[model samples]
Target: MPQNDRHKEREIPIEFDFYNTLESLPVDNRCTIIMISCGSTTVKINEHIQTVTAPAVLCISQYDNFQCLERTHLSAKVFHFDPWYIKACLNFENLDDSVPIDKQYVYDRNMLYMFTKHHGYFQGIFNLTPQQYIRLNELMLMIGAETYAQSDDYWTCRIRRMLRQALNCIYDIYVDQCKLNFYELSENSNPVTICTDYIHANYRNNISLNFLCELVHLNRTTLNQRFKQQLNCTCIEYLLHYRLKISQELLSNTNLKIDDIANQCGFKYGSYFNRQFTKYLGISPSEFRKNPTGYSVKESRGKP
Candidate 1:
């Protein structure tokens, strides 16, 4: 079989729901796509208010703290996905790399991955046209149906197809409607946003303090100072914690081996990963993986 045609079987991290009202965000704090099929509502996301109307689409991520401030006759289809899902679906089951250069054109609107970076960043909400509403609604129905049924091994691929279509439709309208600030990004970019965004996107990569300093155009001390002033931690500290955060997620949410988890989270060695995890969280990786808790490394500082 051709390499392009060969697909590895695995789980896809996406969810679908029908909501009479979006009283709350997606369960487990996953990223979500809210398709407002009817009525209208206004929501406050991270203190920024935006109104979403019928035949409209809104996307939010785990970081988006949103509340429904007002609503009228709101009914919707909700699609929630893991950050890894966008990568998984697009790459046809390969989870490691972002789109390879050769395979970039394989998926339309590969921007779906970019759209999910930060909650409400890159313009996640859109008002759909009547025709778009009809088409997207049909795709949603197909997605919802397939998600519940899981009729075959190819189920996820089918759902991914519909999802890509839906996101593409949203992107078409979103591009024309929202004046995205890509052109003037340099002016708007900040040290914190730049560094944090890079960490989030490339946590899996082999990253270093020097590389980060060069990437953000800052020296070690100045970068650490900026991070401390705003975030209360140095850049390297933030990267370590971010990797641990992801490792914690994989420990609890996935069945991957501890060694694999370590590698995936960018730890050079399994022993080093275990030592850091134990030192910070007060438990070995294997111990935590076996009997995991919602342990916050900074909050509870793990069990005694």
Candidate 2:
């Protein structure tokens, strides 16, 4: 692979190789690393370890440590990017404020939050379906090509767009898998896990505390106490936050009407939704959609 000295720091760096590349890349906390296996292999990311076959994806946050525990018939492609690089390439402002930052590892804190809240079903390993694997592979190839080409005309914009699309693709796969696992674990998992999974799987529905209690076979008082004990928030509060988060994403990414977005996010009244959005974000949904970078949860709510 060819390297570009001019973009040695500015551009998002990607490595597409089988074995040698892994040995040369240091375990630095300056960037978030994603490793995609091209064949079946076993790997360790921090204390969590898993064995996945080809076309699987694993993400190592900037705060976590990683090592390749074992390798048999394994080939992989790895990509890493500094938080600032991801912010500049994707045009996300105040990304550091939205995500927790450390000297050791880089991460989009918002994205990691969503993954932990919604897609914790998979633990650490993200096993991709064959179709998703192919799409991600192609996207990685495009990113690699753009990095090597370093065209002065439009390559920078092209690379950013491709990188954003790849990230969105990975997110969609996680969401789909979470839904699948939700149904499969409906009968097997513990009450708290099941309740949380239910929220993730059906946040778009009009779910009330009673609905959650019935779904998880617990009474109102027990459910509330246990849920607060485990997640530090009542069931209803969690649902409200979940809806607000989804509404924020729709506002940032789409041109949908506020009312429509509210409806899609399970809010029965747009006015109520607007009030909650303003309360949590300290800005109207309209303002947030226009300039998402201006507001920071850390500054407003003092929380990630």
Candidate 3:
């Protein structure tokens, strides 16, 4: 396979392969792994074992011990990429390296944070619906084809775009599954659930840690700890992020003035809102509103 080196850095740290090509389980390094089952198989990541039937997906993070315990009539497609590749593709920073507990699928943490204010982690396995399975399979096939395409001026760019699309599909499925699982697991009392609901419902008004503590009947210290434990973020962080989300929606979907948007999204001052928006998204509200699609890293870097 040919590799592309740009500015002395690898343009894309990615590999595509088939399950039957494996002679042994490869040691995990800096790469993230995506495997789709073509038939029933049992695999172990760290100490957790999962059975994946045909059309199922499994995502393995860097440094996790993985083993295929049982395979019968197994054929699969696999994709591997490093964190830098993901960061370049998604235009985000400080991405989490921790492997989610759920083995059924993997998703981008930042995308999930933007929507849910939670690290994209979940317990239990997910089985894709028939439609989802078909869609993901088709995406993986496209990625596999691009991975081996003849090298050209746009080869790397094409692969990156396909990979990003595949990641987005997985993320959409993850979000839907997480929503259903959250309700099922919490029965409506999960700390993360309660806090997220409250933030979404009350982001237009000021929210404080003490107020959340009072509402949830937990002390300030306990509330912070549990919130972090469940969501991988502090309650206050979640509140700020949720408010920013609302602001972004307004910026994209409404002609509301910046000051009004800030106030409606719980920011006391528009200047503070602008600062936070720039800090988080690397783009000002005005810039994003003018060309929302240009906010992506690809655009910032002058790539397609």
Candidate 4:
């Protein structure tokens, strides 16, 4: 990785036939960064695998332990996500680890296949051909950049909403082109659809187990078990994490007072909000605002 702007911007170059294993990971506390792979590289993490082609921005957070299982022919450019530079509410400190093709997400092969088939179109987007996975990394960078560049809170929020909608369109194209493998597992009923709506509808309020049970028509036991089994986390965990993520975006992008942000993110009291933010993110809201460029977390706790 090429380090520029004093750890604020970086570039990684991966060459063909290159292989490396990060058996012992580094312990550096820095802000989250965007990586632009310059060439074909295969990355493996336990059973999960990512084969990169074309130039793609790989977002790495301070919260992640990137135990690189294996890699091949990897080269890329990397840049840092400084909250002050971008002026967004998103905390680059937390990273999202949800598997892309799981129940809560719709897998689209069209988007993947398009990149794989016509590698040229995405060549400019990524430095690394034969592009297999395209949307996730690219979209991440797009949102990151847009959030950083836009100052208007309303426009920033609107842009993120549209970006999500665009992601849905990409998913549609992907589903139309390639058959989703996970759909079969959820044939009897699509739990994700119901649960997604429930969370989105009532996330701002105090969403409890009984409430979710009544809303989804599932018992507490079943809901708990299936939620963890399918989505890899409990419902409440997901809700809090999601709320915090949105709050981060709001904090960096808007001039809303801390109390108002707390209320907007479903926290009744600003003190509780401060505690939660500090507990999960290592830094208080005030400190984060003061030095948006500082991206390291004191301890690991939450995901973005």
Give, for candidate 4, the lowest lDDT window spanning 10 residues: 12-21
TM-scores of all candidate predictions against the true structure: 0.47, 0.46, 0.47, 0.36
Question: What is the alpha-carbon lDDT of model 2 when measured against the actual structure?
Answer: 0.61
lDDT of 2 by residue, 143-194 (tens): 7677667766566567667766767777676567567875346343466666
Q: Per-residue lDDT for 10-41 in model 4, tens only?
A: 33211111122233322233333234444444
Query: Candidate 1, clashing residue pairs?
Result: none
- Name the regions of candidate 3 deviating beyond 4 angstroms: 1-11, 20-33, 89-93, 97-125, 182-304
Which residue ranges in model 1 land beyond 4 Å of their true spot? 1-11, 26-29, 89-110, 117-123, 178-304
Model 4 regions lying over 4 Å from their true place: 1-189, 293-304
How does each model score on lDDT?
0.69, 0.61, 0.61, 0.47
lDDT top scorer: 1
By lDDT, is 3 or 4 better? Answer: 3
After superposition on all C-alphas, the RMSD of every candidate to the true structure, in Å, is: 17.6, 19.7, 21.2, 21.9
Native-to-model Cα distance after best TM-score fit, residue 166 in candidate 2, in Å: 0.8
Q: Considering lDDT, where higher is better, how would the candidates rank from best to worst?
A: 1, 3, 2, 4
Models sorted by TM-score, best on top = 1, 3, 2, 4
Candidate 2: C-alpha RMSD after superposition: 19.7
